[model samples]
Target: MPSLPTIVLVDDAAEVRSLVRLQLRLAGLGEVVGEGADGRDAVVLAAQWSPDVMLLDVSMPDLDGLGALPQVLEASPRTRVVMYSGFTDPALAEEAVRRGAVSFVQKSTDLDALVGEVRRLLPGEQPAAAPDAVPGAEDHDPRAAARELEQHVERFAGVFDDAAIGMATLTLQGRLVRANSALARVLGRESADVVGNHYPEVVRSGGDADGRLTAALERATRGDDDVVEVEHRYRGSHLRTTFSPVRDQRGRPLYVFAQCQDVTRQRQAEDQLRQAERRFRLLVEAVEDYAIFMLDPTGHIASWNSGAQRSKGWTAEEIVGQHFRVFYPVEVARSGHPEHELMLALRDGSYHEEGWRVRRDGSRFWAHVTITAVHDEEGHHIGFAKVTRDNSERHRLLEEQERYARALAEANERLERANHQLAAAAEDQAQFLAVTAHELRTPVSVLSMSGRTLGEHWRELDESERDEILEGMETSSARLQRLLGDLLTTSRIQASTLDLRLEDVELAAALAPTVDELRRVHVGAELRLEVEAGTRVRADPGRLAQVIENLVANAVKHGAPPITIRALAVEHSVEIEVRDAGEGVPVELLPRLFERFTSRGAGGTGLGLHIVRELSRAQGGDAWYDPVRTAFVVRLPASGPP
Candidate 1:
């Protein structure tokens, strides 16, 4: 009669809103004047109608109920907003109440209770007094009241029959009084068949099911608690069962309301997780190439794998409680390197290094080690995981390669030296060709000139003139012959075929003819002979003579006047000295004095001194220069010992 207490319904599901509206009408509690499918529409409808009560769903597409709550209240100041949701979260209900919601209701609440709550909150509504205390309460029509009670019971029955969750009611004697279709389906039976059956006999126990059902039911019946829950298997299906006691008005337990949920998927997921952990343990234990282990925060060894036992030479029993620093060399351990590595790993999440590590026998091996910080789900550092690989073989190979590289470098240096020597020899050969041509041309020019002069002026010249011309030709011929002989001797020496006819001879006598000839040829230079008579030497006469000739000729070409030839006897040798009066060779050129192609000035060929040394040596003597005395001295083996 109070304008039917108009209401506005808001829900995302049209069916849910329709159900609530039907329940309200059937219970004779209120009239739903308007409806909206979402919170935004709900706000608009509440403003337009200014309904007495607004039943708003919490979760809706676009502009949820909480977000629209204040706006709706602002628009319709007198509207009482009730937040309702399928979620049974008490915190959400409390929050909604705090945010100006007059009340909160779960979508799963019995239709009678929901209707009663709406009716209680209706405008101008007063709480009903007890039937005995109310004036004229007994005068009400029995038929109408009976019909209203019947509709309430029918609505409750409708909800219970249509519920998606498995639900049933059990009497205090443990007999099923009523069962929903969902619960009957879970038990693979008809609702009528389940209603009369004993609960414990219908639901069988599973693995380790030691009277859990009887215990949970007994606890609920004894008033110890309103609800008792247990997870067990029934008919090969995992189920989570909750027993809630439904008490009478006097607080005596009347029935147990049971809820059963199929949790097979959840149980399967848990089983898979346990199996994965077991497989990981087996894998870690089987690995043997790398030392895999864990270290606690204080650097003590915590876990060790089979790989760790083989690689680090420590069994789990030996190393598990020990400090990780024992695996490091003494020097490394003393330097706090192990702790430093752990600190780095903790700070940066991981650290890696390749260095020396000690084994159980105190032998050292190069190892590549990795340390990774291990943390719990809350991100608190607990310890470190370490992986170590022996790299000693790689290190040895690297060292061997370095040694091979050094040896190759030394060989390259030797090859470079040989190449330099070859280049020098090529240069000397080129110089010899040029100098020999010049030396040969000088003698040929003299012969050509003397022959032409003799042929043209033979009759016109006097005897002395002819004799002088003939003598000049003879000298040129002899010079040509001597040059040819030097070339031949050099060839023979190179071939290692220069044979010496050894003989004993007086050294002074052997040098006398060479000196006289040199004196006759160089009329301007004076010759002095300092001879020690009876200075005998073992010598080849021709080769020794050639040595004296080349030395004297060198002195004649390079020295000033007063060339002195001295012969002396020394221990085990005869010393022949050709001295000149000139400053000696430059100190820088002294080392290469007897080398081929070494000449002070251009007139004489550079081969002279080189040939002199070779020929002197062939005759069992050696030729060398005296820098201090400006002398070329020859030492021949003495013919007779002193």
Candidate 2:
């Protein structure tokens, strides 16, 4: 029985060491003699176990596998070291090669390679780079060198087939001599099917232009270093080909090499980016309200659009390098607000506001402005994007509306005053109607009675008796004429043009005539006309006479006759009351009864009492109905005796 070669496994994890040990033993190459969890322990264990091969993990605590490789070799001089780790660090692998490591294998399921490397490194076999291992040297086996080269070719063939990029080789005549599985897949054909065909003919079958392929081949044949990107349609699908010239060391063309990759998705993205840029340009130019442009970091204008010329009166050629502060007034520029606003946008990415801006012609405008910082994909600040709108028209429209509103308010105030005066005039006309009705009805009643009586006694009377009766009728006729004159005076007050003929008149003297007139008209009721003898009021005598007559007449019509007319004179004014025995006014209606059309009497036109109220006021006094006493009071400014 031959003694089985000893194996030492090293890893930082127990599970990895256990699995590796199980796999190695299952392969029947060797039995695990010892195990270690770190590089240092692996080195110690190698010396202790004296294993034929030491499988060491490249990464460990305290000492990494590469650091412990020398220690493992020195401690166990006869033992072989094979680096086993998950990381494929080329630097670590090269270092192991320099440091006399037997071989390097990845920590994966390629356990056969592990056993093979171990078997090749066992004692009595020369190293890969032994001094006499080269062909044509002493003790060199030509058969062994040829066998090694064949194995290298087989391994490289598998690698070429599995490469990520498509690889192909063409002969000097542009024949597709050799092509990997990946290359065939890119061109949508089988590797064996295109082997004897010309490269251009195969590409033409796949929808690539024959002329483009031929031109590239010609360049490659001349050894001028041809390289190009070609697109081909294969199996109704698109493919991208990257072609490079393969040249010999003597500067002669050998074969053309081509690598193909799927650039369809990348090309689509670039097309989409171009379309998006086109749409953005259209949208920016279509904006009619904003003067959008770009500004360099120093606030110099960079580009201009149609809106810029329309809004700011500056064309692109004239303003491209001009400072943007030209759009600001002198005070605004002096305040450094424009520069500060741009700096803020540069710092924070966006700044927006509305303010007054100056145009190229020095005219000012209200502007809505925004400054946004443009940045690169890596977040480096580039410059500011500015957009401005001319809002001066809207501002002027608002000012016009405000001016119209102020004018409307003033007109409304004047109209309100005119309405109030018209209301007063209407009320005076109403009062005059009531007063005229009472004043004229008395004389009309007497003339009616006197003419009837004279007609009845004409046959019995003598000439003297008829003449005296006619003279009495004539006196009453004259009295009726005087009453009509007073009615005319109150109508002038309604037209808003009542003229006062001022005169010194005694209050008592004005009352006597009105009292006598009332007695004749309202004989069915008691009438009391009392005057404070020395009472006088300053006013138009004719107007005062009209005032006294109106008060007495109102007492007769609205009050029970035997209506008392009492006058009391004070320092500044005189008060006359027409006491009525009629039903007192309602509490709610008392205030409006003096207003025009406020009377509830059927025969009353509502203007009679309203006219008397206005007439009293026009004389610089006021008239009011006292609800408490059921009487109408007329206050008049005092006049001294004539």
Candidate 3:
């Protein structure tokens, strides 16, 4: 039995060390002659123990397995180290390969694969090959030599006339002695015709007199070089021809062997690939505003050409294999936007959006992006291809323009409303001024005309005429006084300064005085007052008198002569109605009759009825017109507790 090879086990954990040692023992690989807890320990232990194979963990507290690999190799040149770690980081795997680590495994890798790796790295292990001892050797023991010669013959015959490339043999003088079927076919001749032909007869150009064939043949024959391949033309067709010299026992050149291969398809495919690459480069350059790139299956950037770097401000080295979340802002990153988008794309085959993305310096830019899932020919999703464009400037301009439009619309609406209010105010002011002037002018003209008449007719006037003139003067003076009183009362009412002197009084008592005043002012109207004598109400005296007087005046001036004032006691109030036997007010004007300046007659200030209504309301009473009876009614509180 062969001696057992020594093995070294290195791991950061003690359990993995025992587990691997047990497995290796069961597999009969070797005994664990050395152990290490870290990459540095592995390196030191390997130098001291000089084991046949060193197994090291790729990750450790100090130096990683990959980092310590070169030191271990330098320390013990013959020791073979195998790397293992829980990390699936491809960069680490690639680095392990680069540093000449013989094997790599994840911690949870299949036990069979782990055993296979350990066995492959074991020293003094030979591959299963043909046995060195030949069959039927017996006492002569020449069978091994005979078998080696047979193998050489079999290999030489097996490749001599391969189909893909044609082979043939020629003499030193360039005469063809033998040819394979493929070579005959290439020359457009039968084998019999090509076998005895010379190179000059077969080649369109006379045998490369440039001495290339001669030099190749000389090197092979003198054992200087084994084989030579030259690109030459035969029958005006390009051919890759290989030359080797066949020699005798004394190493003298017997024949020059040549093989020809057709490379047209391969060269054409290469040219097509080059053209495709050129078009791809042009396409990438033409898209100036977009960052287009590719990602590996694990969402790491795989390809970042010039266009991507220019648009995103990321160099190829900075972004490749790093998570795409680097492009998202911190808020977006924490929300897992980049990962969510990738998942959606993987499920749906695409994702598209426009939003803000962060740059390396932490500034933001608006981006329009399209992510398309990349797949193999069989439709298995392999990765993602992303195209992003910086649309920050255009987005900003559009938002600014929309805001301007909204502002302009608001300004126009405000201006229109202001113009309308100004027009309305102008009309109201003009109406008020015209009405005021007319009311004043009529009174002043009456007083002036009466005075002038008295002055002119004093000598001619008898006692009766003088009395009438004096009475006319008195009437005009009373009218002027009434006008002034109404004006002052309206002003007080508008300013909310009118004070009420409340008292309990009979409703009839209030109406009697106003009726007498109305008859004295105009004897033409026939007025009558009827009331329940003892029916009383609680109200302001001056204000109640003003209400009755205004109603009586309204009827006398605007209605026919006969007027009747009636009073009654209802459940909680006394109602006084002033009725006129006259043409009823126009139905259209009834709704606004009690409003200020809404009287029918020109002599009426119109404030009389408005004041009447407002005074009644102020005394905890109300006034309303009864259109059915051509009557206006005033209702006051009864003399009782509310």
- CA lDDT, every model vs. true structure: 0.72, 0.66, 0.67
Model 1 lDDT tens row, 223-273: 566457777777787877777654432344444667777888878988997
Q: Estimate each model's TM-score.
A: 0.38, 0.31, 0.35
Which ten contiguous residues of candidate 3 have the minimum total lDDT?
128-137
The count of residue-pair clashes in candidate 1 stands at 1
Runs with alpha carbons beyond 4 Å of true place in candidate 1: 1-363, 366-414, 449-453, 456-475, 583-588
lDDT per residue (tens digit) for residues 293-371 in model 2:
9998889999998889989999899999998999999998999998999988987889988899988898999897889
RMSD to true structure for each model, in Å: 54.7, 54.8, 56.6
Candidate 1: residue 573 Cα off by (Å): 2.8
